[model samples]
Target: MSPAATRTDRLPYSHSSRETKDADDHAACLSNWQQRYDQLSAGSFSGVFEEFCFGNVQLFREGLNQSVHQSGIAWPGSRTFAVPVAIEGTGWFGGEVYDAHSMLTLGGSDELDFRTPRRLEILACTADARALCDYAQQVDHRNIEAELAARSIAPASPEQVTALGKLLATMMASLRATPALLHHAQMRKAMEQALFATLLDTLASATTASASPASCRTRQLVVAQARAYMEAHIDEPITVADLCIELGVSRRTLQYSFQDVLNLNPVKFLRAIRLNAVRRALKSADANGRETVADIAARWGFWHLSHFAAEYKAMFDELPSETLKRRI
Candidate 1:
């Protein structure tokens, strides 16, 4: 944390939490997340998050010991950029497992299933997708989504990710300590634009290696094998490295194959399949039976009911609760 804000700082919105040790505390800290979960019952919960909403964007730094999965009919009305500030356990976001060297970029309407086994810390900022797209064109006159898919979660250079993380840390500190500076509308807008520009630059610098024809064929095979593996192990936790080891290919190769052929991140594809499987189970079972949404979701490895229900509804246009409530 930075020095306390002086009277001169003037940011419009500012909120934060010390740390979360219980379910109620965690839930309260993440009210803006628009998510509901039973972190208390799950156990081993610890988390914190801070937010600064200014101009046309929202910035936050959040950390948790539990996995997070969210789904909804529509995505948030802003583009999102997430970078790992620090990570201890394995987690998946932006369709890619959080690595020491990667960044996740999502369009306004992108649905995400973020999961982790241990501690996961992230710095994220959200701005209107249209606004960001227009801003990109104004700067470079290029289609930002074309080059980097609307929801691209590719491997980024470690150096760049680290740099962005540092910048976010500084920004967070400033927001916390310099409230007076943010009160000025002009100053706040300038700060917002500068942060957005930095985020864009960091994303534009991410490098995903191009694959050759032979490599592409290899990736296709890898993708098929990987899909098979995911289906076989749908009920268990799976990781990107696990797929790489199973297919005897480098992580980079597998990543490229999925992006080139499926246009989906492997992690996300796995999640989608799992969600579909859960839906099928729900629809097939006797609605009159005692099976609850949480029970069924847990069977499919979805622990957060609210996140699961939201996601379930987004995909099928109905809630998991609705699915479980209707009789055959």
Candidate 2:
């Protein structure tokens, strides 16, 4: 059989399930996730709901609530990887806590055994190994599979970890807000390349000691503290001075720390985080147009409607109203 010619005009397949309320609902939501594997199961019962699949990868932002779960993923000898962008609550994966820094293997025969009493929010990126290698070859003629296989859960640099999280969040938001992008072949392929490149770069540089371990750990702690503060007070107004006081660091120290980790100052990072939060609130709001964009922005600390709209568009490639209206 010959390969079919690529169809530029074909619509990209998009699937999203409503919120799951029971075991049957959860199974329906996770049907696609299990289809890629040969065997899968869950220990305890809870809810699972999500929108999955984009381009050559499956992008999942899952809302999970359960006591324990286990699955055997067999991708039929294909090389593939899964990145857990952000993990909330606590669980165990391979005898270690499955936190924000962990990556899951989706191909081959791998097992996922985890237990947690609380709910979890997880974003995962799963892609084909061959496609990733082809993308890596364009950048550097190295053995991409060798680099990927070097570590099941590659320890990424702090900045790389943060970047990957942002990439997943951005992709999820974009797919939901602008589903038309899925139909754009060139755009989807470009995004797939972008994802693979980030994975390759992060995985390949796992062992390079460009920075001292102590310094790296310290910087990660600082960034984590700052993020925690921002997330805790997301609805309250925050300033650089406020962060400095709350984090027990000077203004210059805080500025330099954020620059090193996020490549953006503290203020910009807060804005970006708030932008994402606002976008989420808009998407999850009532579809009957009962909620206003201004209300959502204000909830996320954006009081200036005009300024918020511009920054929202710049960050998400769409107006705030557009995101809300799309839900309807």
Candidate 3:
């Protein structure tokens, strides 16, 4: 079945607000991007997205109530910047731990890798690439072409980050209270310029940091390679020993790599990934109903039915059968 439609209201430019109970549904709420969200923490998943756009610029606030691993390619030909306004625990963006002081930048079809904590709220802005660069050159009197290409997770001052978050939040609140404000051409133009100027100023104030230690970088690479291998052979029965041998690392090294990079052991992380995969398959099952819960579970290498069901329900707060029954 097709995904549930997002609730959107027509405005002078465009404004949308969506709340979703399903992770993938939340992933689909963002326009002009390919994204997939895997629920990591237990219990039910909830997400909120509020977006406003004028001309070539877009600003939005997104919140998730559960820990999730989000990976996707963001809007093509656009430069996107994200600031974490709140976080329940540790979060990662593009392999680096991020906090409220961090600003994540993505340019021109860059891949997105974010592992967010529960109750995470982010304020983000996306603008047409050429327009943003031109604006920076004309107003900021600076060339940001190289910086955008690098797309680093630069550190901005906490005050600047907080101010930017507040600006976006206040704008969203105002728009929600007075949707007709979007009809005011001068108001829209002023808001748009304010957003671009604030974001560019935040970027300008960011400072570069020293590189990560070689050992840490190596572990990150190992984890990335291992994850790719697991996804490629998800249907096969693979073990830690297999990963150790394949990656030419000791068992301790593999263990440390997973822990350091994802705060998860290899085994548990792999299982969670497979479980999410099974859930997605069940949700997207055909109307003909050719697959059973057990059939789908086995396809993802879960041969023990009872054990799988218990773990699935524990993670999602719903039985596999219930999920299949909801399939459209």
Please state the error at residue 177 of candidate 2 in Å: 0.9
Q: List the residue pairs that clash in candidate 3.
A: none
lDDT of 1: 0.62
lDDT (Cα, tens digit) per residue for candidate 2, span 88-145: 5556654566556666444444454444435566666666556665555544334666
- Predicted candidate 3 versus true structure: per-residue lDDT over 1-328, tens digit per residue: 0011222444456778999999999999877678999999999988899887766777788999999999988666678888888887678887688776888888756788889987799988877777767665554444566665665585468887888888887777766765555564545555665676677667663331222233888899999999889888866545554576577764456667889999999878867877888889999999696777766765565534566799999999999999999988
Off by over 4 Å in 1: 1-11, 23-32, 38-42, 67-75, 150-152, 205-328
Q: Go through the candidates in order and give the clash count of each.
A: 13, 0, 0
| Cα displacement (Å) at residue 140, model 3 | 1.8
Residue 4 CA displacement from its true place in model 2, Å: 13
- Best-first order by lDDT: 3, 1, 2
